[model samples]
Target: MEQESFRERRQAQAMGIDLPLGNSPADIRRRMEAIEFLLERSIQIPGTKYAIGLDAVIGLLPVVGDLIAAAMGSFIIWEAKRLGLPRWKLWRMVGNIALDTTLGAVPLAGDAFDLLFRSNSRNLRIVKRHLDKHHPETQIIEG
Candidate 1:
């Protein structure tokens, strides 16, 4: 069963498809966590405790960078919607993305803000809270 699922997932990837059929709560949690990592904490600065991800790195490219970051951030909201999150929660997530994109568009200050704000991580937290309450089975016990 696992092999078949893996094969189907691979086939979907090969065809540039992202099927929603396989999006169980656990799957959504994993996807959201991976995205949060990529956008907010994928890299650690050498010899320092600070970390940054593609969101911060790409957000250095002026207008285009902020736009790309906003788009990536939108994916988290998309996944949350899949879980039937409340409208208010979705709006809150959208607001975070808007704030990040708007403020992060302000040249140097924006880049600095992107590094600190971590909107994706915020969205992930919101999703995690909802999932924990409504989908406890998806909770992963990290040791």
Candidate 2:
């Protein structure tokens, strides 16, 4: 059975089909967590309870900053696409990034927006929902 499965996977790969192998739910979750940390809350504000990440720090660089942050945010979208999320869901994720970038371009306001928006985290949630609904094996059931 294993040999047949391996043979079929190889055939699929040879045919240019991207198959999800060994990408268990745990792996996806860990990826999401890392992305969230990078884009959302990797640093804590001194003498304050608020947290921030690279996304906000990068967004502080004027025009180029928001662009860089948007580019980083696209990573989550790319992962969602790899997971075979529906078009609408993908669009929604794009919208989140778009909104984050658009509003994040507004100098002071944009930096604040980046601090609060956390588009990567939102995209991660969308990916998780899609995985739970479409890929049962990737779902992490809680007691």
Candidate 3:
């Protein structure tokens, strides 16, 4: 089972406690996949056929939408730290959030931006690729 909560996994890593399948690539893939669900929207979503996701609906909450979504992006950043992603790549992940938040803050445009940008999900994929290259649990520090 893939837990989409980046905050929870980041905590587990910081504690040096790897839950079962928590550090596996499959788990990373699954977590990253959640971003997809969050970015989904209604009205057949332009390019996509279906229309549904936490992001579009959540944005309707007003005031809390972007903040909550941005916080979710932070989890990906935190996970990158624990998983030992390279600084360059890590920044790229951070940039995703920066861009996402900026556009998501707009009025009507922000909603459109959130639907298209999907920063949290995109950042997760970036980190996910790094995890696949080097299994998080098997990482060994080499000074």
Which residue pairs in model 2 clash with each other?
none
Can you write out model 1's per-residue Cα lDDT over 1-143, one digit (the tens) per residue? Answer: 88887887787667544433457999888878877887898788999999899999999999899999899889999999999999999999999999999999999999999988989999999999999999999999989
Model 1 TM-score is 0.86
Report how far residue 131 has shifted in candidate 2, in Å.
Answer: 1.6
lDDT for 12 (candidate 1) = 61
Model 3, range 12-67, lDDT digits (tens) per residue? 56754343347655554554554444444323557967675666656655557877
Q: Provide C-alpha RMSD values for all models, in order.
A: 4.7, 8.9, 8.9
The lDDT values for all models are 0.90, 0.80, 0.65
**Which stretches of candidate 3 lie above 4 Å from their native place?**
1-21, 35-48, 136-143
- Candidate 2: count of backbone clashes, pairs at least 3 residues apart or interchain: 0
Q: Using alpha carbons, what is the TM-score of model 2?
A: 0.76
Ranking by TM-score: 1, 2, 3
lDDT of 2 at 52: 94
Better of 1 and 2 by TM-score: 1
Cα displacement (angstroms), candidate 3, residue 139, comes to 16
